[model samples]
Target: MSTGLGWRDGRAVLSAVHGRRVHEREVVPGVEVGWLLGGPRRCIGAWLEGQDERTPCPHHAVIAADGAAVQCASCQSVDRGLALARDQILDDGRTYRLYLAWFGEGLLKVGLTAEQRGTSRLLEQGALAWTFAARGALPAVRRAELTVAASGLARERFKSRVKPDHWWEHGDVDHRRALLTDARVRAHELLRGHGVELLADHPVTDHVGVFGLTDGAPDVYRAVEALADGAVLAGRLRPPIGRHLLLDQPDDGTPLLLDTRLLTGWTLAPAAGRPSAGLALSERVRPAEPDTQEALF
Candidate 1:
């Protein structure tokens, strides 16, 4: 069945920073909230301060200048529908998104998912090995904040399409992918907040083609090599709608692609660079073993 909440009456715009701080408060009448993601940090739910944690629900629905709609699991999905509906502006001068990033330490491969409720999954083959955007760490530090805009009536535009998967399913993966083509392209067409960067690009091909190029079936190095090659050949990089890839270059021009295709873990360093605390060459790492197998990190 479809789950949803009714809109509050005459509520003002809600904004939260993206950081470790939990923004808990009541947004509109008849609606009580515990926390919202502020700054560039992921939107972590306010737990009882330490038990087995859970995602937070700010509101059943958001009513911005543009209009109103149900809150999906992630901001990225909801924002896709929003962008097609109307212009929305959050209090912090930003709208919403599915921010993603990648880190490395060696051969470990990983992936992550986020939204208004915080990280959904961080996997070593979709097997929740660890938190994607853990409370603190690498991917979190360099995470790229990406989003789409929408508001009141605008959100309604795509509600039906996004309702099925709830927030777990990206409202419009393909459409959102296209929007990421130019983060600023739809800004003029909608109302949103600041700090919005141009949408990064990812290949139009499937995950297998994009992530299957390296020794590991789903390693980020393969994804990175593919991305860098794609960027070099096509003159740009395109990140999958809900995924992230990190690429680094050594001073001498050696390139390393940090593989986060599994747990949003690891960093990419150049081949000739010294092995620091969290350093390892993509080539030196094994094909499909946990990075922890070696002292790569």
Candidate 2:
């Protein structure tokens, strides 16, 4: 709750806004992560970024957390009006790179990111294995993304709530690699005359070590209950996958999964001496699919 900013560099850096300025802190694995839900969730405020300078919300408005977004209406307008990834604006004069990300078996999806961000976007999205496809202006890259999705080479969307179940491999690495490589190859062929610069063949980048998908992962885990005021979460955390936080409950050794979206706008307090984190753990069941209108991060 100390920061209202989103994750940067995958799970390592947690960005925040304080004193009307943005600050970033590194999040290391095995670190004790503790916080109390002190107050009702507030709007995270608006980040109105223009071409030359970034702007914060002047209103500093607040709202309830029952809705999907943690932003006020004014802030959302700015985000939806210009955010390139939202597919509202095109040709913002920014270079973009297309990528194919594999979440699980048959969960490969095509997406694009600004070239400057490199692989952090993939890490943020918790892609188990991924590779770059092409680089070009936003319009071209976006076109390729849609084309791939349309051709059934790879879809444009996947239910992220199901990603944790795919972090660990069902069997061997070769199978996953083959799947990703095959998609990348077919996608490249489809995009041959699309006017984007095709990237050379590269090995699929696996995130097992950074995401702790091997020894540190749980064969089965419990999902944390809904967010409400006064809820306290305390644990040792592994490197987060996208917005998902994997926690080790020190007292009971329960492996808990917290979807950060549940806590994005909640104000939190230090829970240093709390004997136990009074969490209502739930049996792991697949969550309902997200709304089709929801924008991809």
Which numbered prediction scores highest in TM-score against the true structure? 2
Residue 268 miss distance in model 1 (angstroms): 45
TM-scores for all candidates: the values are 0.19, 0.85
Please, what are the lDDT tens digits per residue for candidate 1 over residues 1-297? Answer: 011111122112222322323222222322212111111112223223234433343542232211122233454343432333232322222233332222121112222232332332221122111122112222331132211212211111122212111222222335443433333233323323332332334232222222222222222222222111101211112222222222333343332332222211111222232321223233422244347756864
lDDT (C-alpha, whole model) for all candidates: 0.25, 0.72
lDDT of 2 at 210: 67
Q: Model 2: how far is 36 from its true place, Å?
A: 1.5
Q: What TM-score would candidate 1 get against the native?
A: 0.19
Candidate 2's residue-wise lDDT over 1-297, tens digit each? 444324454546655555556656676788886788766666665545553333445675656654446677777778633366578787878898999988877788899988877787788777778899899998899889999999987888877666776664534567767888888889988998997998867778877666767553575667875666788877887777766787777765657887766676676767875633555667664445568776754
